[model samples]
Target: MKVRAATEADLPAILAIYNHAVVHSTCTADYQPQTLAQRRQWFDVRVQAKLPVLVAVGEGGVVAGWASLNPFKERAGYRFTVENSVYIHPERRGQGIGKLLLEPLIAEARALGMHVIIAGIDSENAASIRLHERFGFRNVGHLPQVIYKFDRWLDVVYLQLSM
Candidate 1:
């Protein structure tokens, strides 16, 4: 597998993975599937801001997973901090795709002079939490019952990694 920057051609695969998680899992809190146009806008914004959006290409040039470093907040005070996102193709989970996508993401953030990287994961997602922990991300906050989805409340665990 190869890890590299994402391109326009990878958007469909990226969108599919994200939408699958949106519809079938708690990896993301969004309930509605994003339209291609919406995803395009998101990509454009990131590109314009020079944020890192990377994709992991597996055999056959398939996009197995993707990761990105997004602005933590609009406030200038948060400029040095970024929020990290990783999404694996549902069928490709457990193949170390997340790990493959994340290592370089951290490096990319640090390369960009980011002060810290944050990961907000579903509390029940042990795999994700473990993945972040493996990279030395420490738990700094846990918000219980903060998200309503799938007819229940979901907790969010925030992990921080100083760059």
Candidate 2:
């Protein structure tokens, strides 16, 4: 497997992975699968912000997973903090792809002079919580029943890693 920066060609695969999560999991709050144009706009925003978007490519150059850093807030005071996201293809779960994608994101954050990295994860996702914990992220806040998805209320846990 190879971990590197994403290119224009990788957006479709990334969109598929994200849409799968939107339809099948509560990891993201988006209720519907986004259109390709929406995904393109998202990519453009990230690029304009000079943020890193990385992909893990496996055999045949397939995108196994992707990760990115997003601005934690819009205010200038929040510029030093970023929120991180990682998505692994369902078929590629439990293969350490999440770890591989996240580790580099941390380094990228540090390189960007970020003061903190945050992860707002589904509270029920123990694996994701554990993955963040393994990377020294601490559970900073928990908002119960804050999201309605899949016909039920879902909780969100905020994890943070300060540099």
Candidate 3:
């Protein structure tokens, strides 16, 4: 596998991975599967803001996973902090692809003068929690019932790794 910066060409696979999570899991709170145009607009915004979007490509040139450093908030005071997202192909979990995709994003964020990297994970997602923990992220806060999905109230845990 090889890791590299993402481009427009990766959006289809990225969208597929993201929509899969949205439709099947609480990894993301999005209730509807996002359209390609929406994903493209998202990518464009990230570009406009000069953020990093990375992808992990595996055999046969498939995008197995992706990670991004997004602004935590629109307020200027929050500019130094970034929120992170990582999604791996369901069939490709437990193979360190997420680690490969996330570690570099953290480094990139720090290089860009970010003070912290935050991961808001579904409270019940042990794999995501463990993944962030392995990279020195600590559980900083929890918001109960912040989201309602799959006909259930879902809790969210905020983990932070200071740069």
Global CA lDDT computed for model 3: 0.94
Q: What is the per-residue lDDT of model 3 for residues 75-126, given as tens digits with 9 covering 90 to 100?
A: 9899999999999999999999999988899889988999999999999999
After aligning candidate 2 to the native by TM-score, how far in Å is the CA of 91 from where it should be? 0.4
Q: Which 10-residue window in model 1 sums to the lowest lDDT? A: 88-97
Residue 3's lDDT within candidate 2 is 98
The sequence of per-residue lDDT tens digits that candidate 2 reaches over residues 43-142 is 9989999999999999999999999999889999999999999999999999999999999999999999999999999999998999999999999999
Candidate 3 lowest-lDDT run of ten: 101-110
> What's the TM-score of every candidate structure?
0.98, 0.99, 0.98
Cα-based lDDT for every prediction:
0.94, 0.95, 0.94
Ranking by lDDT: 2, 3, 1
List where candidate 1 sits over 4 angstroms from the true fold.
Answer: none
> How does residue 123 of candidate 2 score in lDDT?
99
Q: What local lDDT does model 3 show for residue 69?
A: 89
Q: In candidate 3, which residue ranges exceed 4 Å CA deviation?
A: none
